[model samples]
Target: MAEYITEQKRTLKKILEDNCDRAYTVDELFCKMQALYPSKAPGKSTVYRLITHLVNEGAVKRFIKDGERKAAYQIVMGEHCDCHLHLKCTDCGKLIHLNDKISDELLSTVQSTSDFSVNEEATVLFGTCGSCKKHSER
Candidate 1:
């Protein structure tokens, strides 16, 4: 079997560094690994193992979308913080990560009223993007 990853850890590091925001499915990531080493593609088992290992190391992140069987993966950058919310466009589905801090009152009100902890990392609000809104009105 061809070994695509000579230094497996380094490969993961490079991929994360290359595109932190670009989310990729495991299969997609496997395809990318093949591209990185056209002559030595990792097998399915190897790919799964690598992904699992990376996730456990906190080097990768995973999320589910559209009720898919597989989760999307991205590289973890800096300290994992719940200090942002994602703005997702309802029309185009374009997503932007918002890093603006929330006022203590609002945060407190949400916590106290809802009796729930707010996770900034997974907080995604859906709305029309500026371009989409303008286009729609016209």
Candidate 2:
């Protein structure tokens, strides 16, 4: 069995994974966490503590998105945690993570030629969102 994370850690991770689109402040994270774990709403310090733990364990990733905050966290899954490239959309500010959809020969060439490994992680692919594109055309 996967070792059970503490209640705070598990709940926090769950909330983060569910809301992968945006980063959250401590208070915001606390509120979201409470939705799943209403009986245990931790203070800011406790929340921070759990986040730090998740970070160190590589279960979470921190990056700066176009927001008022300095950094945001996203839960890492499978090979997405070891991403090689990221895509960011300029018009709508929507970020979607991507892994390469490439041919085996090309993939082999890259591995042989470059000093990098295939990061089969989700990368943020940014582009005008559908709503933005629709509005812009009008």
Candidate 3:
């Protein structure tokens, strides 16, 4: 038989999937969950537990952004968790998945030059996105 997914888990999954472009704090996710399912909203602890479970299962990715007290969580789709650097926008809090030939070249360079193997899963670069930069300049 197929494993049964709980309602709370389904709701949380939907929220993360829907906001894949941005990361959400535990509190923020809780609030959104409550809004979506006020009658059966999971508690804060439950949200945290579920998120942790997802992370361990490789279905979600969690990271701390600069100047943030709480860690943020985002859904991991397909090969995103395996081979891409995440770019986080400081101004808009948008998370962009970067997978380019240059990134591969950089990885090759690092491997060729040193014994250190880059951890792509945990790699993140923070900067203002183009839209945010333009908005700030205007």
Candidate achieving the largest lDDT: 3
Over 4 Å off, model 1: 1-6, 78-138
Best to worst by lDDT, what's the order? 3, 1, 2
Sliding window of 10 residues with minimal summed lDDT for model 1:
76-85
Model 1 local distance difference test score: 0.65
Q: Candidate 2: where are CA atoms >4 Å away? A: 1-5, 78-95, 98-138
Please count the clashing residue pairs in each candidate, in the order shown.
0, 13, 0
| lDDT of candidate 2 over 1-138, digit per residue (tens) | 234338668778877766655556676787776676677777778888888888899877665544345556666543343433444556534455444444334456768999565543443445765555776788
Roughly what TM-score does model 3 have, to 2 decimal places?
A: 0.57
What is the per-residue lDDT of model 1 for residues 1-138, given as tens digits with 9 covering 90 to 100?
235453765675577557655667778877887889776667767777877777888777666533356677766552333455556666644455454565335566798999977776656788877767887788
What is the lDDT for 32 in model 2? 77
lDDT of 3 by residue, 27-126 (tens): 9999998898898888999889888988898788787744566788888664344566678777756678776666677778898999678897778789
For model 2, give the 10-residue run with minimal summed lDDT: 78-87
Cα misplacement distance, residue 63 of candidate 2 (Å): 2.5
Q: Each prediction's TM-score against the native?
A: 0.51, 0.53, 0.57
Q: Judge candidate 3 at residue 129 and give its lDDT.
A: 83
